[model samples]
Target chain A: MHMIQSVGIIGCGALGRNLFHNLKPLEGLTVECFCRSIEKDDSLYQSSVRKIEELFHCDLILIAVSDQDIIEVGQILNAYSGIVAHCSGATPLHNFNGKGGVFYPLQSFSRSVIRSFKEIPLFIEGDNEETTIQLYSFAQRLSNQVEQLSSEKRQKLHLAAVVSQNFSNHLIALTQAYLEKEGISFQALIPLLEEGLGNALYQNAREIQSGPARRKDTKTLDAHLSLLKEEKRLLPLYEQLSESIKTYYEEDF
Target chain B: MHMIQSVGIIGCGALGRNLFHNLKPLEGLTVECFCRSIEKDDSLYQSSVRKIEELFHCDLILIAVSDQDIIEVGQILNAYSGIVAHCSGATPLHNFNGKGGVFYPLQSFSRSVIRSFKEIPLFIEGDNEETTIQLYSFAQRLSNQVEQLSSEKRQKLHLAAVVSQNFSNHLIALTQAYLEKEGISFQALIPLLEEGLGNALYQNAREIQSGPARRKDTKTLDAHLSLLKEEKRLLPLYEQLSESIKTYYEEDF
Candidate 1:
């Protein structure tokens, strides 16, 4: 917790790599990244890659691996005396060993996309006040937004996040699949999708909801189900999703 | 089928009002709007209000009422000599009797908000070629994007639209409800939602999906389900949506 003079990042995935580059430029801090299987030599952060043992000497060790790998990586740092934090929104703060903390960057990151961490919200939590302040100051150096959130609230945030981001993406993917199955151009829905998104952003989504499900129009529902009957994969999805919507808004009518 | 010099609009809902005001200023087009129960006097389109008997005099009659009323309105317009068109995406073109057609403006409409139809896709269909051409020209005068779509294809579009627009809106509303219930700020998820939407727009949504469901991370899924167990409404939604996503990507693994 002493000024975080040295920082170590595990995993070379999107979040880990971005964190490495973003933190490396800060003055008076030695940065290192540990990758189990490093990529080709042509990568940008190749020079910063280090073995796991070298990271044990750092002031803070941050794990940015997959959900399945988080526990293993945390176990590997059992001997390390430094604060061990994770970059996952879903994973608990207890996954690590001594001085456990969370440095969750709550945003969508991709290997192909270069993201600026300045605008990303960094939710930090530490096992103790000292470690919390350490992570807070550490996060301040990289991002404009930093907040100390409890693990319970952070987990709930993660759940809401799945509903907000992943579920919407899957719905869109399903729509695209439906359009492709019908031999229709996906471009036709783009404008409507944009408008719908704009409306949801500016207005409360529940009040703005419109469809056969929202109206409980049995006739249209039956007709749509009849059309989707041929699509074995999509028919159940349509039924379940519509049923869910109908149930959600049943009290209004 | 002749020149649509006189345009009569039925219903005074969001779409009807907007269409009335939009078409009123056009040259050589006498626009009249007929509302079953007109609003208070001082409303913008109050002067354009007329009875169903008066609508029978126009060259084109557009019924823009709710789905359940479409049939009754169409029946009432059977004696009208002009082209009777229903402005709906789900309703088939056969609802009307004489010169049946559709002038479905495929976009979100609201009574409180003013919308421009220039970018909205106007899908037009008619009983015959001459009527289609007449409707096409009339649509061209209102908005830029216009196309001739079949009743069958238009019905399919309406279904896909419910999936793409309404389903996503409901998902967001669910997320908002979850955040509010957990005493978390909804603003925290905005950037993430925007990023996810951007990724979906630029990349294939099926490929960009990242979550416990997409990764099939059972541990995280279990943790989330445990947290959601208290909410009876969201629990089943989480189960069904995740199950659908898992089943959809089962072939990938």
Candidate 2:
């Protein structure tokens, strides 16, 4: 696999914008960002070209549009014979028309958050070995953690990621909301939350598990449930998650 | 309220051991640990006094036993007239005898993990103003983030801590298990996990939430459920948590 000379990014959303910014500075990598908006003093990569055909001059085209629009972008690039990929974790490789590949970064990005691509784990899957190697080489330039995964396995990884990120964040949100109702500030819980994450990273979660649910402290559990009774939406989640924790620990006990 | 001259810790578990180590280094604070084990030329503050009455010598007695043993420790300390506090977050102030107070650190501690008390949110509550001020001054020596919280509010905070720590760690465990089965390393997901925690700390979780669940993508959800069918324990948690996310976002849509 050789160094990628040029790369084209479609869409200017968080993923695309970050991708463009990350790839733009890499040596021997010329990035062209295609978007609807254009400025007179736009960067060298920013292009107002709406025609997908005109922007197919790059060695690779990275689709960073919405999930629904990914297939359409692939279809529009069907005429091009160059390597094509989408930055979607959940989407399958078959969505692309030609030289299909997935260059999904297992990360949650926002316009405001200045995230470095150095440690972001990238999952690349392609229609064939050649495409996979090409995308892997391209991804390696942007991130140190790059691996080749099958579409099936990548989908599973994506699902696991949803649990690790979205579901975990939801639990934190529940914590914040519960404390807010009690006139306690959210900042107070940050240390506990950070320590919890640190423990999860370094230790086995099973051994490190604590709380009323894991301890089977019915009194504390009942007190929490009573406190959450008024929170109709949270009550069910609290019960379900706590019940799961209890069930998991009870097996060992 | 001016300063704590001497302190007694009642347990030798993770919290008690760590507290003794942290407090022993502070100026003007002499920590006497009351544990079962006694050693010759033991470190400063390692007092293996089997007699509970000997703990009454300190200005304050901090009970650091397990939740079940807290009441018994408090009962033993019923004869003492000095300020008494339990380090248990879930246990209320009423559980203690004499001048009761709470000196709860909002951080998780493990035997193997070396954690500093600095910046750890210290939630303190006493039966009365005098006890509260005395404990506050003592807590100030150990940490900068100290606050006075009512028992009712601290119990709610404990519940919130359980969600943020236990439930979230369970999700990370789930991630590790899933990835390991696929021959993927846990280290691969650390960046994403760290980023997710950073997001929850700084941004609004609801606004930053992402995934097929947030998008209500039924196709991906079905695929994930099928993949998780073999995981009897994790499947239900996956379904319930995803459903909760779906429900939360659906209301807005």
Candidate 3:
């Protein structure tokens, strides 16, 4: 890898913009950002995000667009002679030309919040050994934890991330709505949740799994099912989730 | 309500044992433990847990038994002349004659962990005003957060708790198992989960809901489904959960 000095970031969504600002502090690195329209805050990226053609010759070009746009963006950056990577878990390394790679950050980014990139896990992959090392070194500069993950392994990781982070968060949100509808304070459950999650983390989630479904307490489960009779929307979800729990614990592996 | 000087706790399960140990420190209160058989650790409860006859005459007998056993224990204490509260979210207040009440703690307890009982929310319910106040004041001594919740409301609270804490914890367990199967360190996902959860709590889970399903990104969603195909048990769960997420956000009310 030639002594990489300049980096180009595409898109100004949550991740793209954040990477542009976060990478600016690296020693002797000139960061440039490209987007269709340059917003006021996006000026942090080399004064303003210009055009994609301006980024073609940079030492490294990272496409921070959505999964659907990754292939198109990669094609647009096809002329680039440097390493071209798309920060996507779903998109593969072969989406771009010979030098294409991946620089995916596992954490979900918010457009408004400028967060420290140090703790986020960045998964890197490249077309070849040289590109792999180049991409790994670049990702290591942004996040302390960087792994050389393949397209298949990275997809599995993304699926796990979706179920654990996104699904659990949605479940909490449903509970929040339930409590609010019942005229109960959602704050009442926060202490209990914190303690439960703490115990799960400490003792391991498998060892400490409990509740009516885990216990196979038919009476309690039936009572809950009846309680959700009016909540037709949540009824099927509750059933599906309960069935999954039972299948996991009760069935033979 | 008479100044309850004596308290009797029945059963030696996780919540029961924990409550018995925690309530021992209340100033000027005599606490007795009554279980079928006393184990070595049961010595902390008035030297040892004895027969149910000994707990019958106590000023306040808290039946810390399972939901199914609450009625039996309440009947055994029916000969008493004071508040007989069953510390159950599932069992109602009408189980223990006119003196029947509820002293349910909202947090799950482990038998081995002697956790500080300060922050756990205790929901109190009684058949009458006198019993309600008696249980409320008694519970206030045990935990800082005490509320007079009706049986219906407490049932609703318990349902919310089941879905939020228990279900979400199980999701993480599944994710852990998946990551382990792939020979990936579960530690990699922790940082992302913590950061994502923090943002969800701060901004709101509903506002921060992002994932293939939520975005209606069929390509990524299909990729995840196929990835989970090798995991036969998890494939249905993946589909159902994704469907629920789509229903919650994508569909019109």
In order, what DockQ does each candidate have? 0.71, 0.74, 0.73
Question: What's model 3's lDDT at A112?
Answer: 84
The predicted structure with the larger TM-score, 1 or 2, is 1
Cα displacement (Å) at residue A173, model 2:
1.4
lDDT (Cα, tens digit) per residue for candidate 1, span A81-148: 98999888988787365599999988978777768789889999998889999999989998999999
lDDT of 1 by residue, B25-126 (tens): 889999888887765663655556556877788999989899889888888886888898898888888736658899999887888776778888899999
What TM-score does candidate 3 get on C-alpha atoms?
A: 0.96
- Chain A TM-score (model 3): 0.94
- Lowest summed lDDT over 10 consecutive residues: which window, candidate 2 chain A? A42-51
Candidate 3, A1-253: lDDT as tens digits: 4767889888889998789879988998888888877656445644444678888778888888888988877778767788888898877777466787898888888888888889888899988888889889878888898899998888888888898888888888788778888898877788777767655554578767888888888898999999999886578878988888887887665
lDDT of model 3 at position A109: 81
Calculate each model's fnat, 2 decimals: 0.69, 0.84, 0.73
- Looking at model 1, residue A207 earns an lDDT score of 88
Q: List the residue pairs that clash in candidate 1.
A: none
Predicted model with the maximum DockQ: 2
Better of 1 and 3 by lDDT: 1
> Candidate 2: deviation at residue A71, Å?
1.6
* Angstrom error at residue B33, model 2: 2.6
